[model samples]
Target: MASNNTPVSAQQPTMRRVLKMSEDEIKKQIRSTHNQTKQKLDFDPFYLFDVVKNILNPSIIVVDNIVQGKAKDMEKGNQGESSPKACFIPPCMLKRLSYEMACKVPGEEIAYETTISILRNVLSSYPWHVKAVLTLASFALDYGEFSHLADQIDSSDQLTKSLGILKQVPIVLGRQGVEKYKNSFGKLNTLIKLTLDVVECVVELEKRIDGNNTKDVPELSLAIENMSIDVFWTIITVVDCMSRICALINDKNNTQELLPFTGKITSILKSLTDQIAVCDRQIAEIKAYLKFKRDLESLQDIVEFFKKLIFVEESHNLQQATISNNELSKKTEGLRKKKVLLFFSDFDISEKVVSILKPICEEESRKDQYEIVWIPIVKNWTDIVQSKCKVNEKYFWYVVRQFSSVLGIKYVKEQWGFKDKPIVVVLSSEAKVEHKDAFHMIQTWGIEAYPFTFERERELRNREDWFGSTIDFIPDVLTWMKEEKYIFLYGGEETWIKKFEDEATKVTNDPDISSEEISIKLFNVGKTCKAKDYLGIFLKNLNKLFFSKSQKETELDTKTKEIQMLLSYMNDGEGWVVLCKGHKLVFSGNGTKVVMALKSINDGKQGLHKSTEIQVLLKQRYNEIILPVTCCKFTANTNSGWVHGDCAKCPECSQIMEMIINFKCCHKGHPTKAVP
Candidate 1:
């Protein structure tokens, strides 16, 4: 029932370094920093220790284990991969509380900061009874770490889940534990939110390093300067304190209050004092901006020189980037058209459909009076249009950037076509197989699928009996025809447009009605053709889908799922080593477990799976002390099954997705491997 946020008063400090400062000295430091004068300030030193001593206690490990245990239990139950989440009554007045801080709530004003992330869940938002709760809550909010508790908030059965988590804040983030996050994850900027959380924590430690608790500590600043969003204040303070301490330790002027702080205290305080003074001076200058225009003008003289060089560099980059963006935009736009649907399967209904359209499209000699459309059906397709048009792949993203950029999507969705005409979609053969669901979704509305044969049309149009004018290649010509006039529908949403079949009958009963007069136009993909060399042609065009970011979602989802599953297997219990015979050994999977397993058994990337290497090593290390964790997961290639799962419970909401794992399932619409 207990968690890390519980506050305890006074215990021997584990990472609890302490310092002593005189009342006069503390008063002077606080006054100098705040630009205020204080007379005869009195505070009880013993009581202050009583208040925070437990904060540094070693018993925090017990607190962490208790909380971690709660998490384990949450995962044991089968709620699936994440904690069971219920929709909390959406607090009507508050919206993204982090961004809403400008409203200036009362106690929050004291903790006011622009960079603070909203408390991720209720524990952080309403941390009652717990003293450290308020402080840790403040820290969590400061670094935008509220999201780490997303699983907790979402899984929360009710407000009580949050309350439970609020109880364990203190011990869970204590020095040694906190340092683990700080040193490895913090330095690398692995998780920005996590880093910010650590930054908030380190800031607390940095401000406290002086050990003069009487003075108020400044809140951590979250605004980024240049690219430096992750400098840990703890490292800065330690280095600063050591530097000054080295100089002062040689000077033997030991006093009563600081005698307790002893050597390093003097230098650390001096450095802090100097830095604060400079900051104070800068703040003063910014505050007098208007009044100091003349002085600023002097500074402007230097800025002007820097401005010219910066402008030139920025302008050049923008120009090149803009031109590149324009070309890619044109290519993606070109692919959006009322093109015909061409299938590459022989003896399929596609041939019959193309036969039907040929008389209309190719029979320019016939008075059909309708525009001919061209669509192609190719298998194993992607949304990439670069090689299909031979343009720079990078331009796709650049074109995307020309629009609004947001999380996940760098570019805003671009709508093509004018209100004056109906859009027709061309479906390729591969699309039908990949988007069978999309077809159903369209069928719900009643649209028909069609196919086309541009190869035959090209031959027919090239003959002297034709208009006697040569045209762009069939596919390229169809792409060029789209322009700002029409949008292409892919797969089945086109079927939905045909759902108004009766309306199509009512509006333009004549088969010759122009697309410009209709609200929705359905172009049935009619013909199919078998490619003589499908694989070779497909691979040659693969470059576009492989490189063009126009279809970036396809790439990102694959890579992300791959990485997630990859990390999951590494963290899973499956990647380990155990001795069965006489020696130690490593097991299946790679990365973390593989590296650690190798180190344990003195093995390398020796292609071991399902405990293969470990079984062999067991023959040699039977006499040595070893730890063993069972590995699972069976494959056809090997005669063994390896186990992989992180059976951890939800720390917040108590909901758990059993055996945390991310798999790319085709049924789930994640295509990591080939369709087969």
Candidate 2:
């Protein structure tokens, strides 16, 4: 078979108006050109056509037998196993059709008229696809015989050489004749292949319509509507093909005569191809809808199925979770009747958070009670996501295999109030939403925050002191807590950080300060938070803690207020410090007050005694510099799951802070500035 990739022409033009026309319009157009009474068969002619088609492109045995003077044996009985009699079609019927079709094939003088007359008179009783196939079968017979004879022209047998001369195969296969008609033979072969393709597509469409009763489907309907015009063009092109074959064999006319008909048939082939695609899509959609219906009906566990359905939309087939694609059951079977965390995010999840959660998930104590399933939400599963999934495959307790669901992402956002940030939605075995988002809880308490629920989160919040240790993600903080040391958590630009460190060193090392009674430590919160290994995940988690849905300044949960203050200091782009003495805040100040207080003590302006504790002296001086209008500003991404309240409070005095909406951008090599 010739590859369809062969171009019919440079432009590759197609029949533009045929597919767009209504059924009646197509019939009217057909009537305008070739007004002939089309044919129908009592039973499908494809059964017989298939048998004849095989003989047209016969095997080497058939070729050898035919060339060996056994051609008459084909019509009488089976010549051998490769013969047409192997099929269900009667040999006599194949003989009759081939004889009639060969007789009616158009002559060179009036090729077009004779083709139309054949369609009208002799083959008019057959269906459109049948008409096309019958003509192609007739042409294939001549093609097979001519090809075989040309192959046998140089044979040792005298009978083969004699038959080649009688058939005029030697004249066409001769050196000079070959050069003259090479392009013509190539074109005729391409047209015949293209005709076979169209006839096959037409038959396929008919079979689908009959088998599925899908003729009324819009896509298939439009395809069926255009079949008449498609079939008409195909049959005429086949006839033109036979005419070209006759001209080529007889050496009486130029094979260039088939070019115009080849172009028309190519257009018809393209039309049939496009129609088949539309029909196939419709068939697939119907199949999917039926499958979805069946799945819904067959579902034994609606809760488990609905949970699965939420993540895998209608487009994907619902099956057991495997290492290949989206499924949640098998890997999560141990977590049955327990809380399951659906970790929803885009492909860009925090590796630091994943690293922390991995050990906790693998811990034997908690393995049976809980499980986390990473459901990566994305619009399309691109290569980057695929690579990211591979990189983090072992880190997650369980993750759907290359799973991406835009609808699932939408549901997470609208129903559970998820935003640009990743969220952990907790579901009980009963499939009830235990928590809309427990991501913040996990960040705050790690494994201690087990059965991450709204009640447990509230209980944890109630237990926390307003000024307690929240930066435990850092390793040294636990040591500082054990030592009962005063830790100064501060952040600003590089210059301000250096200045505060120098001032604190001077204040702490002073002879007047009692180093034996008080231990002091300094931490650059901003710089430490952005270490490459952690990648600012600590800062994000801290921000989430502050912006959590449970956060309300008016409520007694002072940890949220402290987190708000810390984040505000970092977001302000100015030097600030908060003093924590053994996991409790002593005092907090901006650079102006904290640095000035240290300088005042260093200059002996406060008249500090030799036995005075450094932290007490520093706090007293810092308080002296405080202003009445204490403003604290915090910046957060609007889409980062921050549930907006009516107002916030100043961590300094518990005064209701005024709210203002400000948009900020921090592009590369530029300071973050607020939009006016």
Candidate 3:
């Protein structure tokens, strides 16, 4: 056989050998191509379909040495249905190609949202089938992408849509068709996993569809419910197909040796089942919550109560206000400006009247000619009225004794109510009034006293019910606030505040005043601003003040031109607003006859006077009226400075009636003693 030329060299690669590749080389080629398709397609179904469309063509694969099939046309490995008529590619070949793709697709990277959106949108356009979605989901698990798959499938809005979709992917899969040939693509672990996954998905989808009958759970409310249904279906499909793959491991005539193939199959199933169960438990809680939602209607009353409190308690605020309107000056134009020396019994009028007086002096429209005795130890009418309830008297002499302190006054306390009490007298004659800054006294000429007013004891019985109202206060406060000429008192008499007290500090007190309509568009502001209705005092005193000012203006007591011009305001009704008792306007009298009530008691007595001689005699001459004596002094007998009985002085001519005097012109005169 070794003939000439050592004939024929060592045999080169034979024709058959040239046509074939080594097992390792074949795997590398398949694996390299696998990575390329998977990278491009990713989780994109349309993209994968496109890749299949591009790379797969007739004659690309040969079956039994005949080039009559595409790569997807290989059915020896397919586990499920045949290819779509459009695809013309067998499902077995598609499974092999897809397995190779998913195996190469790494497990680490997978974003569910992108894949899910594409799947849902693709379904909307082409078909209502869940088949493609389940297939993609199967591929995901092959690459450890179950979570990504679950996330996407759970997008079904309601259980209705989810179950409806689950119904399409086969649940109790036929044991004969795809299941019989699932392991044809042997040794590629990902391929077997993918086949098993698809089958199980179909089954669990069937269970979800079946679970709908109980109607126990709602639409997919939680993340877990959707996952359990979807993944449970996936696990069953995997288990069933993988069971066939288990047999393939023993038949090991194949090119690959997937070590522990059965274990991988079982381990994956365990992982998926456990994950699905966890999802089920989580969803169970969500369902329970949905079934027992609380009734919101029970809290309606309580909510309303707090809403009202929000207005009453929180909206309530204390606001210091200043006197804005100059009705005081305008109304009392013709009145003489003189100092008033009050002889209070138990009444304290200082605190109540101080606020009114500060504005009167600081008012831009007033002439500051008089000063008020800012008297102190001023009696509070309430304290005085509440002082007496005698413990024992057979007929109750203590009743009037209690009211003896009631000086017939009306007032509002910052801490109490607005009640009309009697005018109270001064408990202390020593007025610390001058101590309260004579300069502050110089600003306005009147004292504010809210003490019990007992000045008129008889009338107190008839006017017990007279008080104030706030309805007419808007116009008065508005007039003062609009001009920036108000008196705000942040503190009491100890720290009486004038309108312009802080020269450099800006006015922080916001007097919210309406420039228009008197009472209609009103807003509540400032604490002290509330009880603004002093109508009772003003109305009762209005006509007396109005008529008197008119008479005084015409008569001209000062006999000066400036006084005449100033008093002219009294002749008009503009001056009457301040004196109008908005508080006392009851059903007692109508507008016309109300003016007559203001006429002074001295009205009827004034007719007896003619000239200076008659006034002098009436004031000086003894008229036989017994006078209560001021305390007496001991002239000769003195002990511890105690005094009793009074010293009599002549009322007529500045002469002591009981003391000796020489001049007859200065002698004490009796009413009958006619002096020439």
Candidate 4:
């Protein structure tokens, strides 16, 4: 007996050691023992509820603590610690946990009630935790569990309690709260879909009740009606808040400062809420009207029907008229201009008119002067027929109809006496007819003659003596070029030079001018050459010519000024029609002018000094011609081909050369062998 007691005393130390072990270690040991037994804990319907209540409840408490400002001390305590400050269960995690719990005990009322209670606690404490509440609600609704809860909420007392919780949600969460938890909620599609499902369900139930006897379970029907309205408004509020928040988030300038602009956002939300309230009132009125229609009182029902019919018709007509008026005002405002040139024509004539008018109309300087309104005289029968058939068309004649209606085409036609298909009616700034003969002007002088015609008409109206050809002579280019001594033809096209040379040869070979006295120099100004530099030189010489005249007391005549004006145009670098020592420009052409000028010089009608003019002409032409020749084609070689130039010397020899091509020769005043 003494030996057995000694062994029992030894077991006391082992038992004390087991008692000293931590609770976690003890639980691990029990779990290990339980696993070894190969036995399972029987499934309990309340197991999920227990799990949520134990595991998720603490997280909700922490969230509540944070929302209530009670966790600040804890946050400060763990600020510098290497360990994590506090347990942070994200709203998404909370949502997932709630969903799992709901899924586990799907059909259990106690499970659903527990979930709702937990979610309500979380929401009430931290009202911005909208995602968690929505998630729990979605789980219940999706699983058909909410319908069970709805059925159980039979008494008005139960319904009112439930409504109380729902009512607080919108008040506490508000628009800002919804915006705060939007990201945590992820896509709102699921929430919106759940809301729609609930609303649809309530609607279907109401329809079924209305289809059958409505008196039975009147409380349930009333409760469902209230639920539908509340749920519908909730959906609207959520969607509106989310949409506004998303818009703000998308704005680059507002994204970082969304919180700072809360006041503005709140104002916008208030406006939206007011609009929703209006919709709610409208819905209630519609529901009342529908109920009134179903009432058994036949006389009252008929009276109500007539009232609704009249109201609907009046609303529709008023809305349509308002829209039409707005559109008409916009069109009228857009078409209103200071001055307009309204042209009316058939399709073919309109196309022709547009082609002619496009150039003048597109000029930037003319934009502010007047507006062009083209109206096709042809009726758009195709568009009219299509419009009757409910098909859309944008035919040119449709625009004509619109304009004709807007501007009173009949009155305009009568006032302007425009009986012709193609006619132009110019309206003044006051929309009064200023010119009715615009079509004739366009036909006579083309679109370029517009505004000029208008100006001329103004002058006529004022009874001012027409400034007949502003400055006397338009200076016949032929007469001006003939007076010049030299003819310098500059052009990029070799064909131009060839034509001129052929014509010049004809002119030189005439009995009046000796072939020996003729001189022709060719310059190939290729595409790469700076033709502008030559233009600049011409401009500088013209400036000198103008200033030289100022030195003389006698003022230049109209012809001389016209000639100078013509010369000023040569700076365009199109082609030079230089004359009289290459200092003057008569005009630009494909050297046709030069050939004519040369012919005229030989004709001796202008009384030009032949010897002095020819000498100065040859000197200037040769000097100006050398620059392009040296830059483009000239190379130092005696075998270079000769060109036609009588009395021209070879650079290598003092002997008079003939057929000197680009001043190149055989070095002995003979043409190269390469020359034909």
Candidate 5:
């Protein structure tokens, strides 16, 4: 019954000495009991508290009803019958513990140290929370029964009056009723609640620790150390409450005699409440740390998978290669659950590959779904290597920090089919190879080739609508299509491009050939034009149609035929032109023929006001045109695996064309030119 008025520190030295001795003695009893038992005594302290909580803290509502002369009404409403959750502790064990604690609760005056010593010996074999629970329960039994009989002691029933008098409930309550001792009852009830809270925190701490090693967590270890003292004080408070109640029942006015014990219990309650908060924080921190550790382990597993995929020899210095960029390891976590593009190249990474991926990586909507790691194959990390890496950094929109030389050139060539040219190898989250060389697909579709698997490539091929798919990404073309304007896409060398642009401008502006209904837009989409990325994608897609593994010339579908026609015009290194109206192909021909056809249409037709009339005349003129013979060689990387056909039809004249294979090797900084 410790009160707020008496501080624990202000106690006399003699009392302090006695408390120190009591603490040591109590610990000895606990250890001796543990050794004698040799096994943990199982009990449900929380369930035991629930069974006796109301008994220890009688309802204020019931007291109010009794004072209002409505005791019968209250009794009728409260049949006192309740079905609590099943208790796991054995009935025999509970009864025995109750008897032991009841016996330990002294009736007459005794020293605080002696009372605690006697109670500790009784509860020595039990856990700290269980000991506190049992003591409170023992007091609850007597106190509850006393209150019940006292409430109905005035009844005509002789049995009730006799029991109330036998337990001295009448004297305890006084002529003024139990309200006369409300202060004492309140103090006892608060102490009981504080004791339960301490028990709950201790139980939670033990559950958190379980059988895990607390050595790594200093907070958990320190909280465990403080628990022993916290539990000891809790048991002391419970025993004092029992004594205080006994004093109240024996003689109401004699409660003053137990003031010192009450004050001690009150102080113990405050101290225990404060310590519970500390324990809670310690447990919380441990939980957070454990969660973080698990997450880190998951990320490390991914890093190791990447290392195994690229690192050829176990003796190779992974730390040196990866740690060169500290951000490499930190950002690897982003690769989890994402398709990773392992960009493998020599010191010279082709601008084609970077340009294709640059816009894809910088796309705000879908960038997070994939990651790219550049694995530069080099003999050693010399100044040349460092310089190359720095130069490539600006081009790499999403620069993955892991640029290591562990993936030697020979390994990439043998294992991944990477030739002198750079290749993008797409890997699924599990590190399984999805696409060996996804560069072709990426070059064709950009971000649409996400996951960059062969399956995705096939899916794009299956859904190909050449005219629509080609210009679907161009907003201006889409608008022109909606307006039913004639759209022309032309590509070529600089000289051919200039001639095509001049002829297209003359046809659109000249009043003699131009029609108000036939609106025309000409785009310069040459390999060296501002929109080279667009031309590159269109060429890669056209190549797929020409050299598709699943289809031949006779088996070629309508879309394939259309794409082959465009490819034929560009294969000779000549300018090419394609005309469409609202996703419908109007005409496609060699750039030279297209320019000549436009000029012919302009010279012959004057004030042509109909689009159909202009289209029919333009097609006739284009068909009648021919240019000088030139090389129609279609050069492609044989390593890309997309090239399948050795022969292809000339879509312009429907003639079979021969395919040639050539090979040449050169040292760094020198590239061999093909002999015409």
Candidate 6:
């Protein structure tokens, strides 16, 4: 059966070729070779023409009928539906015709020209088929046999022409077709992947040419280089066209799910554009190296200025004498022709005050005739006694001298007679005060009041209500006490102290009152009382009295318990004991008197217990008690010393408590001494 089909298949191409010839030639060919055979077969000369006509132009109804028949067959057989077969000239015939057409044109240029022509027809005639055809072409350019054909042609010019054809695809498809393409699952994705594959092929070819070491093919190398650049740019253009189609879909459809993919494509485009820019910049730099050097030098100078502005040190250390007054004076001597502005404040208020003044100082410093100085005052011993001081002097100095001349901070307080902090003084170049109310001038006129002279001062002073107090004396004594943990009780009397103590004890002993609840209630009460001036002051005083009395009682009770426990086991001893009464300390040799003194101090300010006098007594007693203990003929135990644990017993009291020491007793029957 296969042998029987071979002769019939062999005759089909010959018959088609004869049919394609002119009528005269076709009849002549039939007469010359197949005359006897044709007579035996009874073949008509016009029969081939009929077949050719049918192949060239089939009926639309016949095509529709065939599609319907296939659909029915698909349903009956449960097989997948295929594309409707072409009723006109078949794809194989068209491909054969394309080859014949290429042979007619001269050179390899026909291959690229044919590709562009086919692309144009496909893009114009069939919008839906465009992506599929372009995708196939891209894949062919990547890995198919067409890649060799592409390589043979002058890629730079021919590929660019092919690219121009590809570019028209989106335009011909229009917005509606783009919308459909994007909505179709995996369509846009397939296109992007295919385009990227084409790009990769071009890049690989470029790499191969670059890696080739043979010196014989310089022209080929140069041509490949130009081709690669053109191909790269063409691919960029193709990518841009595809991206616009995707963007159109996104705009028309407004689909959120596609956003991630769209964003990725956008980022790829941006990265590609940036790479091109970098290449361009490198080329420009090569061409104009001296110009680039000059620009770079200017850029470096600008960068340095910014670095100094942003990263300059702003911290000032009070303990290390930030800047001496004499140094400030020396600095000012050079600025004698310039107007000076001095700002003074303690650390707390200085932060806010400087924020307002620093900008003005910076602006004024730009003028050659103006000089700005910051004077941070160390008002009290407590300020210095703190473990550390934070001074953002770098920020201040940067602002002061960023554009012009200015003196640094001068740590002077009493010498300048600054009673109130956050004061600003405007001075003449001769070290004479120009405007005493410099702060007020800044407040009223802002930065416009720079170089504040005596006239401006007089105008402000005259407008000021001298009799009316400009100062606001809102004393936040309670807030101060709370923050500082210092309870100051006014009118310290025995009755008042007892009354406060009773009230405090009553509140403390209340089992229902939690510590948190007590704090909240106290805060609310303070808030309410603060609204009333007289009541707030009275309440603050009362609170201090109550707290002091309660705290002292607590300390006295704890000390009494400890002393009683120690005294129980003691036979005889003369030793000084330190005791606390609120924040005050008391020292005495007589244990009984020490207990009495604590009560007296807690009772009221009776002038019976003086801190200085008690301190002196403590020194004398310490010398008498501790000096003897040090000289005593007792062998110190090296094996055991102080053990701060629950199991250890107190040596003096013989009570289960933390063991302080393990000293051998020289005097038998004497109680061992322990330091609390």
Winning model by lDDT: 2
- Candidate 3, 438-504: lDDT as tens digits: 2212221232221212222212212412222222234643454333332221111212122113310
- Model 6: runs farther than 4 Å from truth? 1-146, 153-608, 613-676
Candidate with more favorable, higher TM-score: 1 or 3: 3
**By TM-score, how accurate is candidate 1?**
0.16
Model 1 has an lDDT value of 0.26
- Superposed on all Cα atoms, the candidates' RMSDs to the truth, in angstroms, are 31.1, 17.9, 34.7, 29.5, 27.0, 30.9
Q: Select the stronger candidate by TM-score from 1 and 6.
A: 6
Task: Flag regions of model 1 displaced more than 4 Å.
Answer: 1-254, 257-409, 413-676
- Candidate 2 per-residue lDDT, tens place, 567-633, comes to 6556657677877777666566666567778877777645545334456777667666644323556
lDDT of 4 by residue, 557-588 (tens): 44335334334223223333333222233223
Q: Which is the leading candidate under TM-score?
A: 2
How well does each candidate superpose onto the true structure, as a TM-score?
A: 0.16, 0.44, 0.19, 0.21, 0.38, 0.20
lDDT of each: 0.26, 0.59, 0.27, 0.36, 0.58, 0.34
Candidate 5 segments exceeding 4 Å error: 1-43, 59-82, 85-120, 153-157, 177-182, 211-219, 257-676
In model 5, what is the error at residue 377, expressed in angstroms?
29
Q: For candidate 4, what is the TM-score?
A: 0.21
Clashing pairs in 5: 1-262, 1-263, 1-265, 2-262, 2-263, 2-264, 2-265, 2-266, 3-263
TM-score ranking, high to low: 2, 5, 4, 6, 3, 1
Q: Tell me the TM-score of model 3.
A: 0.19
lDDT of 6 by residue, 1-676 (tens): 0011123345446434522445355233222221122112122212322332222122212222222322212232122123323442322323432332222221112222343343334222322112223323332222222212212222367664465334332232333433444343233333344344334333333343444432322333433433422332233233333333334333333321221233333443454444444444433333343342233334323223222222222222111222223443345444556566666655444465656676676684455776665544443425442222234555444222221101112112222334434567665555556665466456544575566765754343333221011111124433433343212221223443344344334432344333223311111112234345542443233232222223334444433332332222111232223222222222212333232333444343332233333344333333333222221221111111233222354568644442222223355443223223
Per-residue C-alpha lDDT of model 5 across residues 1-676, encoded as one tens digit per residue: 1212333345455455545556567566544443235335565555666666555445333333444435444443343224356655433444554444342333222334544554445666665556656665665676667657756757799998888787776765545645666666655555555565565566656655564456534456755666656666666555656556555665544342223434545565566556556555554544544553343334434455665444323222222333344565556667777878878777666676678778766877877777777766654668867787779877553354334533333345545766545778877776667777777667767778776897887676656334655655566777887787787888878888888888788887866434364578876555454554777766655555455433323575656555645665667576888877776776777777778888887677643666576566677787776545343334432334433222244568633343443222233222111111
* Per-residue lDDT of candidate 1, residues 1-676 (tens digit): 2111212222123112222334344333322222112222133222222222222121222223333432323322231223312532312222343233322211111121221222223213221112122332232232222223322432446664564255332222333333333332222222222322333333333343334221122211211120121221222222222222222222223210111122333333344445444444333333333233323223322223112211112121112111124443343333232232211111112343334333434433322222222212222224453244223212112122121111101000011111111122233322211111121112111121122232332333223222101111124323433321111111122333243233323322332223233222222211122633322222222222222212223345432332233333323422311111111011113223323333444333232232323334423332232334323221111100122111233467533232322233334221121100
